[model samples]
Target: MPAIAYYPPLPLNAGISAILCAGFLFLAFRKLLRDKKRGKATLSITLAAVFAVATAGLVVGSYQQYVVMNTWSYDFRLEVQPNETVRESLIVPIPGESSLLAALHLIAGTANWSFIETIHGRGLYFQFNGSAGLDALFSEFAPGGAYHNTTLTMMNSTAQPGPLTVWIFYSGGGGVTVHFASGGMVMPQSESIAPGWRLHQLLFPPVA
Candidate 1:
């Protein structure tokens, strides 16, 4: 597992970096106007450039981390029925804390499955099959870039009874509260689709 990162808030570091960059630039201008020697003015300008680069690095790195951490929680419900009177079921939970790569590997290992990846336009899809009896589909928008939404489906087979239904939940801070259905009831949809996914696609569509 990759170590979780800890850093000061991006806005806070950005504010400080901007202040330092501006201060250095102001000093460079003052030195150029009042001092006869060019060396002091050149040094101040160099420091300003260094801070400017640092500020840009901070913004870019923070945005990347934000995208990775912005994921959803999934509850996979698998159901198998051998006869009209007998039913068997299994449930797997994939928390938001796990990276998408890790989650895929985990599921494959648990079910003895293999998968193939495909890219269509802006979407990435993974089709998985088990040696004994299982088949699944996984998909996400913009795999490594900004995350929007993900969907998974598993079909039932004779060896493993299933039409696995996955319920997705989105929340801020990666914390989710899942409600399980009981007594032959179905889980309610949080929405027709994830709100964040819809908003992101609307605001930042791929350029032609």
Candidate 2:
């Protein structure tokens, strides 16, 4: 998958912007009231419009922080032995060695996720469709806890095998869902992500 920018939630940024705009508008209004000059109404309305736009931006930003942040862990290991295909080893981990898939089924059918989308220091991409996929979307330090030192490794058990390039995407939420649900996940740039996720034959690539 190509890299995507990660825009984590930030309520404080919005709040601060709003407070600043309000304060500025208040000052402008006070100045206008004290001035013997003309055009007081025009200046006040201009400041009010600025305040309104700032307030709207703050609200939307806050809402996005609430959504698009739900995520969790699917812990499972793959042992790509000699003469083995890579796709079949798609195993996600479970909590407490518990049945993570089983729990997912309880939440919804067929957990929606992309195939190893862009990998990052935090985790790989996985998005749910409808309600089922939503069940698997956990937040930072989610229920299962965050996966650290997460790396994709490849080994050339044989000298004759050809190398492979696996593309990863930051999958979650379709276009419509993303547009409606407070924007979407902040995916890092593809360049930033490629080096992090790329696993050369038998080794992890260096981080860019």
Which candidate leads the pack in TM-score?
1
Best of the candidates, lDDT: 1
lDDT of 2 at 174: 21
Clashing pairs in 1: 79-161, 80-161
RMSD of each candidate? 16.4, 14.8
- Runs in model 1 lying further than 4 Å from the true structure: 1-8, 73-208
Alpha carbon deviation, residue 149, candidate 2 (Å) = 16
Clashes of each: 2, 31
| Residue lDDT tens for model 2, 104-181 | 222332333333322222222333323222233223445444554333322222445454323332222121111101
Q: Report, for every candidate in turn, its global Cα lDDT versus the true structure.
A: 0.41, 0.37
lDDT minimum window of 10 residues, candidate 1: 195-204
Report the Cα lDDT for candidate 2: 0.37
